[model samples]
Target: MAVLDIKNLNVAYKSRNEKVFAVDNVSLSISEGDSVGIVGESGSGKSTLAMAILRLLSENDTEITGEIDFKGKDLLKMDINEFNKIRWKELAVVFQKSMNALSPIHKIGSQLEDIYRVHEPKIAKQKLKEKILSLFKLVNLSDRVYNLYPHELSGGMLQRVSIALSLIHKPPLLILDEATTALDVVTQGQILSEIQKLEQDIKMTRIMITHDMSVVANSCKKVVVMYAGKIMEVGNVEDVLIKPTHPYTQGLMKSFPTLKGEKKELSGIKGFLPNMSEKNKGCIFAPRCSFVQEVCHKVAPKEFEIKSGHLSACHLHGSEIN
Candidate 1:
């Protein structure tokens, strides 16, 4: 069964003059224990989609339409009080900037204690400490980190703490928005490995938002390719990330350098993203597509099933790519 079902979710930042579309008509269903990665360059609405699901976006300037159904409840329509109860307990997020996410003034253990107490208030102090310490060990943190302030810990350590805190609640759905972006390449790999290890025992669905295809390759089973605020492809990582069907997904794969196999010069997709504030009738990636059809510039393409479990939004299909 699906743990989360998002139907035609549209998120736009509105101003007095115009509305900038960040996510438009995007629909996805995430099943339990699925490790899905949403990959795209900056401004592709990957983070925006995560924020919308978490209800972190400010309603004053941001207009969010459609449903964010989480475990049978509509998160978007849920009351703020009720949603707060569900946020970290059932669904949690670990952001890239770990330093900013944590409290600098308080020691790590105390801060974690406060968070745990909010949701699980009746627990004894000794039991809470034991739980926090156990979580630290799970994320591979040192016992010394409990007394250290946020600034005292290294960036990697801080991120580990953040991960531990998120996992403390044992949330069913964990949305990690660029969680490994700010770390060094080696540190990123270590963190990713740690996350994967956690999965073996956690039994939780994970959504990894990143621009790195390799990250998806290393961690996720399924991949969602986003460009210009829309999903270009969605399928198993082997089908979508390895053998991409959409031109944009193909471009993304080409742009990145591969560590193994035949070494070749990287190819970049030429052309900037279309303005989000302006209205466009065509596929937003048409300007940069190498195999663009004439209709691609004139009409928006609906998602067509490319394989048994793969889908793409392009006039062209996978067979025509070769």
Candidate 2:
């Protein structure tokens, strides 16, 4: 069954006199225990989609439309209080920077305890401490580090702590928004490995939002490629990564280095992303696509089902709409 279902979701931010579209008519469904990766360059709306799923965008200046159904309930229609009850307990996020997420003034254990107490106010202090320690071990952190401050740990260790904290309540859905971006190569691998193990052991659903293809290859079973606030392709990770259907996805794959294959020089996609403030009437990626035709510039293509469990949005793929 699908754990989260989003349909025709649109997000726009008002700037001066214009509304900039950050996400446009995007629809996705994530099944239980599935690890899906949202990949794109900056401003591709990957993070915006993640934030929108949790309703974390600013209410005053941002306009969000369409349905966000989480576990059968429409989160977009929920009251703030109702959503709060589900936020940390059912859905949790580990943001990009661990340093900013952690409290510099509070000890790790105390901060974790505060989060636990907020949800379980009457729990005994000793039991909470034990739970915290166990979570620490689960993320491969030593119990000694639990008493230390954020600055006392390395960036990698701090990230591990952040992961541990997110799993404190064992939320059914955990979103990692560039959670491993700042770590070194080896450290990122270790953390990703641990996360995969945790997902298997706990049956947790994960949404890994990142620009790194290698990260998706390592940790995700499915991949969604985004460009200019729209999803260009989505499918099984091996299918999308190994045999990209969309031009944008192909460009992204070519731009990144691979470990197993014969080494090739990286070639980044050309041209800049279109200004979000302007209305796009045709394919958003037409300007940069090498195979762009007149039709691509004049008409927008709907998502086409390339095969079972695979979808792509591109005129070159023809009109096999899914």
Candidate 3:
């Protein structure tokens, strides 16, 4: 069974100017031990989708709908207490910036111990320390550093510590929301390697949200491509990255350098995203799609199965429509 299943998810933010659909109707599933990467440009609803899955968004002006089933529990309808219990135990999230995520006033060890106490209040103090040390080693960090404050640690070390803290309860599902975007290329590579090793050791299900195609290419087995708050394509990492069928996917691929010997120009997709408040008459991506036709602007496209386990939401890919 899939560990995380999202169906017909929609998120909207209301404002005087317009109501923006940050995340449109979208569905995807992640199996146990599966590494799925959600990739898109900035403002493409990648982070919004992640936040919605965690039920962490502000509810004052935003409305969220759809079912998020994690381990047979409907997260959307769960009470705050139930959601609190599920968080950091069944599912944990690693935020984008470690510095901002961790507390500056508290010692790293104290902060981690607090998390452990919250999740497993009955755990003995000595055992908690041992567990924290063990986790530090799992991420290849020194136990002595636990006494240091968040400011004392380098960006890379802070990230590793953050990862360790997030895994204090050994969550079955771990979401990395651009966890390594702040680090240098070499450090990012190291962190990615460590995460891959940890995943193999712990059998953790991972949802990696990143704009970096290289990270997705190296780490994820499956890829979810999003554009303008809607899913454009989904398939095996190799298939979507190397043999992209949708114009948006192709454009993203062209934006990144290829490993193959062929030299290709890195051209970005033209046109800005549609105003979320404006009621779309047709496909959200039609205005920016390279092969858009009259029909594309009149009717929203439905998902078409191109191959087993590979799907695309573009009219051009449909045999009957094209």
Candidate 4:
């Protein structure tokens, strides 16, 4: 059975009396223990999709629709009280900025205790202490740093703390939204490796959201390529990275330098991301696509199944159905 399933999910923000859609008609299903990566450039709505699933977006200025089924339960329709029951215990998120997540004035141990006490307030002090210490050890942090302030920790340590917090209750589903984007290259690589190991050890279904295609190549088993608030392509890591069907996905891989292949200059895609406030009838990426056709600019393309699990949304693949 699928651990997380989203059907026709749409997320839009109110801006100057206009709605700027961030995620448009995205449907995806992730099975148990699957490491899926949603990759796209900034403003591609990958992060917005993550935030929407977590119910972190403010309902006052945002309009969200469609079902977000988590293990057979629709999270979007869940009441606040009911949602809180599983928010951090069964599902958790490690956001992009780790340095700002912790309070500068408080000790790490105290803050961690507060988080634990929220869900398990009746637990004994001794048990809480054991749990905190165990989480610290699991994240490779020394027990001595437990009492240290946020300012006392390095960037990498702070990120580790963030990860430790997300795993506090051993969540079955974990989402990391650009979790390691702020760290140095070496630190990011180390953390990505650790994340992979954590998946194996804890058997957690994870969603890794990032703008870098390389990150997806390193950490994810399945990859979803997003562009202009829409999913352009999705397939297993090896298939998507090795043979991208969508032009946007191909351009993304072309921009990244490969170590195994012959040396080639990084020729990034032309033009910038389109404005999200305005909805277009045709393909959103049509303006920048090298293979843009007359039909691409006149009508939107439906998702075509290229293989068993591989799908791409492009007019070039439309012939498979029509």
lDDT string, candidate 4, 1-322, tens digits: 7999999999999877799989999999999889999988888998899889989999998999999999889999999999999999999999888558788999998998898888989988788878888877766778888889999998778988898899888899999988877677876776677667878988889999887778888889999999978999999999888888889988988898888868988989999999888898999999999889999988999998988889999999933211
* Highest TM-score model number: 1
lDDT of 1 by residue, 188-208 (tens): 777677667666677789999
In candidate 3, stretches whose alpha carbon ends up further than 4 angstroms from where it belongs are 318-322
Most lDDT-accurate candidate = 2
If the candidates were sorted by their lDDT against the true structure, best first, what order would they fall in?
A: 2, 4, 1, 3
Task: Report the C-alpha displacement of residue 6, candidate 4, in angstroms.
Answer: 0.5
Q: Return the TM-score for each candidate structure.
A: 0.96, 0.95, 0.94, 0.94
What TM-score does structure 4 among the candidates reach?
Answer: 0.94
Give candidates' CA RMSD values in order: 1.4, 2.3, 2.2, 2.5
Error of 1 at 89 (Å): 0.5
lDDT winner between candidates 2 and 3: 2
Report lDDT (CA) for all predictions: 0.88, 0.89, 0.86, 0.88
Deviation from truth (RMSD, Å), model 3? 2.2
Model 4 residue runs over 4 Å out of place are 318-322
lDDT of 3 by residue, 1-322 (tens): 7998999999998777678999999898888889999998889899899899888898988899999998898999999898998888888888888557788899999989987888688988888999999888876688888898988988878888887888888788989999878777876787678778777988888999998999999989999999889999999998888788888888898899877787888899899988887768798888888788899999998888999888999888733221
